[model samples]
Target chain A: EAGVAQSPRYKIIEKRQSVAFWCNPISGHATLYWYQQILGQGPKLLIQFQNNGVVDDSQLPKDRFSAERLKGVDSTLKIQPAKLEDSAVYLCASSPRRQSFFEQYFGPGTRLTVT
Target chain B: SQQGEEDPQALSIQEGENATMNCSYKTSINNLQWYRQNSGRGLVHLILIRSNEREKHSGRLRVTLDTSKKSSSLLITASRAADTASYFCATDAAYGGATNKLIFGTGTLLAVQP
Candidate 1:
């Protein structure tokens, strides 16, 4: 009955440094998503997972950002060699199914500040 | 790479007034959804309207979708200060059936003064 959970509500790191965020989706959720939201802009989908397999990663910056949903229950997003542009809030969301038209439940998000 | 753009980037209105925000997207979509985000929090789903639906309503919220115009509008009637937040519209592409990927628009910031 719990909502999606995320850790390290805030993070600060220098350019070229690396950081990782953890997320636990609601019980029985089958879809997980990672999004990046810049100041004054909408959240952009970075990656999506259905169960333990990836459903989409078309917008992910493979060279610097990586995410994995192990066992289809928890997910971790990592950013290596962080850039100034990467300073934004990272959001984790989940849905009961992989089907469309379902509303997503989101976590509080991790705000990253890259200097 | 944003798909939708909301009009009137920001709005300030008094409580009990009606606030309307419009969103226009570039691609065909299977459905459109609206979400709200507070100053320092994650987003909350407000409503979802399918492509076949021209209008939908929730408590104090009315959503109208015009697929022919690739536009949608969200109207909050008798708004309250607690309704102050950023409103965003999202869409899932209709290319090969509806997928889980959602494209969000630049949100509209609404402030309701009590």
Candidate 2:
């Protein structure tokens, strides 16, 4: 079986530039999540989606960050006018929604470097 | 801010020796999970222990959870070079509902020398 997939494995952009990362979850998984892992720290969740609707996005920087899971299969996270602190790895993960508790399968992640 | 802190920020052990890491969280949780991440990669699930459970074993891994103290530990027996990676403990957001929101703790970096 194929694992979660992410694109643009690495990205580098200057401050104030815009950057976006894409993810496609494993087949039949209904729960999707986006997390940011800053250097020297564990991943911090940015948002979560169940199907095409968002379940939680309280941690996302609303002013400059936005994500969408169009068609409930693929998702995209964007950081516009990015800041230096935004440099980190963007990881996407998914789990089956059939159960109340399930393990998440993660993508390789997209490393963003905002210089 | 991170919800939990992993003890022994880093460890270096011989390949045949056992390695252990501990995690402490602040809130009540339905379950606790352990994940592993290689350098510059995403996390992979390792094991999960529910609040009622005390211990769980998987392959060479042993996990213990103490809800009264709100702490968990992961132990890797007969560690190998392949066990070298950062390990993290995560808990549900505990937002008053059954959600998959996970709050991760600072990870423990383990280096096993072959």
**The candidate that achieves the highest DockQ relative to the unseen native structure:** 1
- What is the lDDT, from 0 to 100, of the residue A67 in candidate 1? 94
DockQ of the two-chain complex in candidate 1: 0.82
Question: For model 1, how does the per-residue alpha-carbon lDDT over A49-111 read when each residue is reduced to its tens digit?
Answer: 999999999899999999999998999999998999999999999999988889999999999
Measure candidate 2: CA RMSD.
1.3
lDDT of 1: 0.95
Model 2 lDDT at residue A59: 96
Q: DockQ of every model listed?
A: 0.82, 0.62
- Give interface RMSD for all predictions: 1.0, 2.0
lDDT of 2 by residue, B1-114 (tens): 798899989999999999999999999887889999996555899998878899999999999999989999999999999999999999874556768778899999999999
TM-score each candidate. 0.98, 0.97
Residues B1-114 of candidate 1: C-alpha lDDT, one tens digit per residue? 899999889999999999999999999999999999996656999999999999999999999999999999999999999999999999988887778578999999999999
